[model samples]
Target: MHAMTLRLSPGDDLRAALDHAFRTHALSAAYVLQGIGSLSVARLRYAGRDDAAELRGDIEILTLAGTLSAQGPHLHMSIADADGRVVGGHVAPGCIVRTTAELVIAHLPGERYTREHDAATGFAELVIRAS
Candidate 1:
């Protein structure tokens, strides 16, 4: 596993940035080790919910981690508002950076990743393959 760090500037979309990284690095699969930063706006889908909840304000990114592949990123994040109220859920696009987002990604050069439908889970899931 190879690791790399990414710094996202203000106004950047969190999810979109992850996707762009793979293309830029020519990586087929990677995983987020950890992330911390601030978000001016966050879009998250709470557990068991289908739609995303939009939170706006000075938000502190408490935690961020998940998988990244060509299919897309499957990230989960926790954030806190200025009042210290915390919320977490599936990471979604439109999570705008407030100042900067520092993220570390682990690249798997020997493996490939794809998302395929899983009948049991009723959702597409990660499938790892030999590169």
Candidate 2:
């Protein structure tokens, strides 16, 4: 496994930046080990919810982790607002960075990661395979 750290600038979309890194690195399989930063806007889908909840403010990213695949990223994060109220859920697009975001990602060599629909879960799920 190869590990790399990424720094995202202000105004960057958190998920989009990670996706870009996955493509830029030409990674077949990778996982976001951790992330820390702040977000001016966050879109998160709470459990059992269909849509995302938009949180806007000086939001601090307490935790972030997930897999990265060609299909997309399956990320989850916990964050705290300026008032210190914490919330966590599925990471969605449009999570704009407030200042900076530092992420460490692990790239697995010779492995392929994909997402396929699973009837059991009724959602697309991670599928790992040898490349």
Candidate 3:
């Protein structure tokens, strides 16, 4: 595994930026080991929910971790609002960075990751393969 750190700037879309990195690096598989930063807006899909809950304000990203695949990123994050209330769920697009987002990503060179539909789960799930 090869590891690297990335810093995202203000107004950048967190999910998009990470996706871009995955493409730019030509990585077949990767995992977000850790992430910390702030966001002006956060779109999170809560457990058992079909849509994302939008949170707008000075938000602190408490945790960020997930896998990156050809289909995109499957990430989960915990964020704290100005009031210090914390909520966590699946990360969604349009999560705009407030100031910065620092991330540690590990690239798995020998493995390939993909998402395929799982009948039992009723959602796409990760599929691993040797590259």
> Residue-wise lDDT of candidate 1 within 27-118, one digit each (tens)?
98899999999999999999999999999999999999999988999999999999999999999889999999999999999999999999
How accurate locally is residue 127 in candidate 2, as Cα lDDT from 0 to 100? 94
For candidate 1, the per-residue lDDT at 61 reads 95
| Ten-residue region with minimum lDDT total, candidate 2 | 119-128
Tens digits of per-residue lDDT, candidate 2, 1-131, equal 99999999999999999999999999999999999999999999999999999999899999999999999999999999999999999999999999999999999998999999999999999999999
RMSD of 3: 0.5
TM-score per candidate: 0.98, 0.99, 0.99
Per-residue lDDT tens digits for candidate 3, residues 102-128, read 999999999999999999998899999
How does model 2 fare in lDDT? 0.97
Whichever of 1 and 2 has more lDDT, that candidate is 2
C-alpha displacement of 68 in model 3, angstroms?
Answer: 0.3
Which runs of model 3 end up more than 4 angstroms from their true locations? none
Question: What order do you get sorting by lDDT, best first?
Answer: 3, 2, 1
- Model 2 stretches astray by more than 4 angstroms: none
Residue 9, candidate 1: alpha-carbon lDDT: 99
How high is the CA lDDT of each candidate model?
0.96, 0.97, 0.98
Clashes of each: 0, 0, 0
